[model samples]
Target: MCIIFFQFKPHSASAYRFILAANRDEYYSRPTKPADFWENDCNILSGYLVADFLTEEADGLTYLKKVSSEGHLYNGFNLITAEFNNTKGDTMCYYGNKSGQEPKTLEPGIYGLSNSLLETPWKKLVYGKKLFTDTVKQCNELSQESLVEELINMLNNEEFQLPAPDIEEQGQDFIRPMLKEISALFVRTSSYGTRTNTVILVDAKGHVTFTERTMLNPDANQWKVSSFQFELEI
Candidate 1:
């Protein structure tokens, strides 16, 4: 399972009018896929390359929907994509499980998700909402660069870090799997742990910046940060 959480600010005084802070959480066993926006962005969602599009939804959310993939669908993705001054906020999000859940339009707001369902919690505990609200309040006015660092820290918060004892005292029956699930923004399930943190920001000026911090090993505490900048209308 993967975790992708972000904040979208379309109108702001910051350099990046659109600020997106997100992390991709998966087992150390899962392979990592780096983001690319410096050169060509050829992200294929469902079936269509995210770069190519021109369509409108019933509610005016312009996007092309593809239910089937040319091959097997990649299931380890929790993605939130937007269309800009390319396709209506051209925003489209897809959780790994979409057997019956159809794509729907979304208004501007903060959101987060893991392996479970889009907004529905798989278990009794889900902490994305609190993380979203807290981060937004603290980082809303920060520059794109500063905002990225702040979000990464949230993922590595020790308050809810794995193997927590406080959770156990909450009553084993109540917090068993739930404690781990809700605070799983950063996970270390034996050999699996968070591997990367990414932040993407764009502005009305057609400028884009994508910053990534990758862990060398599952247990390794260090990260190599890479920042990419380019100009695009969307």
Candidate 2:
């Protein structure tokens, strides 16, 4: 599971700015130019170590200091555009240009949402390094419309199969207590033939009680039929 924790802090000017600190396990969607990059929707820089400045006695201290002295490490309120070398009349990899300003060599591959880093100095402090890519690929099953037809046909012919007697009895005993703890539920349906992976959370009372994964065959109506259901704890 890829989980992101968004820590928000209020801004001083009443504008829509926020202080964002996230730790995520999933790959990010890469951003291309001409389209404004959505930080929440895409990944940060390809290679950024937030823990580099954390400890005084760490291993990469000298190297990080050298990189920091070369240029500004963070920018606010704008996306990071590639930096150029004006004197050399050429583009440089380690440097980045901000709002058409002169490029500065900070380090290679450190990026984030514009203006997000300034308020949170802790963001620059990286304690470890990891190799990762933030790219989102288009779904491969998009063009095959026949997948939906197959699902509809399967649902129409299949019979409902209940869980084993022992599991069913166990469910009866545990399901009620689990249902009280669910927080929310979501029902998602993709286009005809498209696959759907959905999760439903139900809180019976105050605690999480029931969780389920319902796989369904896509059809025009709700009778699309349930392919499978599993009980879970929150």
Candidate 3:
């Protein structure tokens, strides 16, 4: 399971500016691929990683310190997009719902996204919706610790399940089993589950904070965490 939920700031000069929190759930046996800034001209660059003061051009634009996720290590169909200040004053962004099978304009507003239904699972969507909405509503300041605590709680909401759609209906399934709850932002399928929980925060001042918490030894028993802070060079 892979989820990407962010905030949208339409109409404003920094409109579509976003703060993203996402998780990747996959089988441990699936040789996991990592994230990095665009490297060689290979297909893997689609889900790549970012480096400090590093820059690479892809998707028709140059990104400084750009990184991506290839879903699972072996292979998967997923690419995440977060708008950033690429060129000091560039004002372009992805405004439609291409992640879905069809073309649809997500009405301007605040929303979250999950791997199940890319457009914020309309099933258990409210849970996610509320999670983000309350976050924006209540929290006066968004820090790495606050984001971690908030997201960890959200990911551990086993009871939170979107009403599953019918089989053969051509829709993704939203079934997160209620197992021995361990971590705040992870799940386990005997051997496979959320390998990492990431929080990316971009404030109104062009400062960027990226934090990643990964499971050590592929076991949800513990987390090895790291954070990076930098200014988005315009």
Pairing residues by index, what is the TM-score of model 2?
A: 0.17
Q: What is the TM-score of each candidate against the true structure?
A: 0.66, 0.17, 0.63
Name the best candidate (by TM-score): 1
Tens-digit lDDT track of model 1 for 165-222: 5445544674465556435566555555567776666765657777787776544566
What are the runs in model 3 whose C-alpha is more than 4 Å off?
10-17, 33-80, 86-108, 141-144, 160-163, 166-186
Looking at model 1, which ten-residue stretch has the lowest summed lDDT?
Answer: 55-64
In candidate 3, position 183 carries an lDDT of 22
Deviation of model 1 at 101, angstroms: 3.6
RMSD of 3: 7.1
Point out the higher-scoring one by lDDT: 2 or 3.
3
Which one wins on lDDT?
1
What is the lDDT for 96 in model 3?
A: 26
Per candidate, the number of residue pairs that clash is 3, 32, 15
What are the clashing pairs of model 1?
Answer: 28-192, 83-89, 83-90
Q: Can you tell me which runs of candidate 2 are displaced by over 4 Å?
A: 1-39, 43-143, 152-158, 174-234
Q: Sort all candidates by TM-score, best to worst.
A: 1, 3, 2
